[model samples]
Target: MATRRFPTREELRVWRDFIETGELVRSAMAARLQKDGLSPGDYTVLLALSEAPGERLRSSELATAVGWERSRLSHHLGRMEKRGLIRREECLTDNRGAEAVLAPAGRAIFQQVNRPHLRDIREIFVDALTPAQLEAAGEIMAALREHLTRE
Candidate 1:
């Protein structure tokens, strides 16, 4: 059998640091979002809806936009509907599909939460990096994304 190359010790250590730090930032951001009664999933869905043309997207499109599976989106949409944050309508173009529309409440609340979210991002991430480091981080992320796409 051919030997498979594992990450070298230094590479492994760097990978661990990257993963752990990313998790810490995500946790901190989630904590801040919880104050606005929004989970990351809620925020993600609202964000996608808010950006769509006419502030609405097909259920499948919304799922793709939020990078969630259909069932997960369906369940989260149910809770959000109960809270009056969003409303679902039968898709006008497709009888068998549905659409997710951003409700007035959802738009208002997303606007309210957006500023603080930006502040949290700056605090947890941008402020910690120097200009050069930030540029490097962007480049590194782009490289990784490109590599993934290739694979």
Candidate 2:
């Protein structure tokens, strides 16, 4: 029988802290977003669209930008469309492709919600970390993302 090597105590501690902190932060942010009638996923999609050129992006590009599957993005986009938050139109560049655009109402809602969202983020995350720690955290997250995205 082969024996498996266990993680070191420090490695376990790091994992635990990472997971716990992530859960807490996500929950906190979700609660605040819910109060504004938006879910995290909704905000993510809106933010991505708002940042795109002319506030529009190809459906596939939007999915990749928001790290969601096409089906999931499609479902969410349907809901958003019903809420007048976004519109889906045929892509001008590709006859078969669709595009997502942020609607005026969506832009207004995002503008209204941004201040509170930023304050909450600052209170729950940025304010809690030193500048150096914040920089390090950003680097660590980027590195992890790069590593995980490798084929």
Candidate 3:
């Protein structure tokens, strides 16, 4: 039987800090968004759609962009449609595919949420880091993302 090597104390400390910071940031952002009547998931979908050309994207493309599964995206889209925040349309390029478009209400809500959200992000995360630290964080995140995506 092979024995697994244990992580060193420094490795453990770094991993713990990384996970704790992520949780803290995520929770804080979720709270701020929820106060504005939006969930983190809703914000993610809206942001992705708002960034896409024509403020729309094919369902599969949206799922990829949001890092969500197809079924989860479909379910969320249905709820957003009911709330009149978004609408799904038949894709012109693919007969079997659909597109998710941000409705005016969704766009308005996102715009309304932006200022306060940005402030909260700055207060809770951004302002704590120097420019160099922010750059390093971005690079670290990119590397981590690439490693995870490779799996």
Tens-digit lDDT track of model 1 for 30-60: 9999999999888999889988999999999
Candidate lDDT (C-alpha), each: 0.93, 0.93, 0.93
lDDT of 2 at 140: 98
Q: What are the TM-scores, per candidate, against the unseen true structure?
A: 0.89, 0.84, 0.85
Top of the candidates by TM-score: 1
Worst lDDT run of 10 residues, candidate 1, spans 1-10
- Give me candidate 2's TM-score against the actual structure: 0.84
A best-first ranking of the candidates according to their TM-score comes to 1, 3, 2
* lDDT assessment of candidate 3: 0.93
- Give Cα distance to truth, residue 119, candidate 3, Å: 2.3
Which residue pairs come into collision in candidate 2? none
- lDDT of model 3 at position 47: 92
- Stretches of candidate 2 above 4 Å error? 1-4, 146-151
RMSD of each: 2.6, 3.1, 3.0
For candidate 3, what is the total of clashing residue pairs? 0
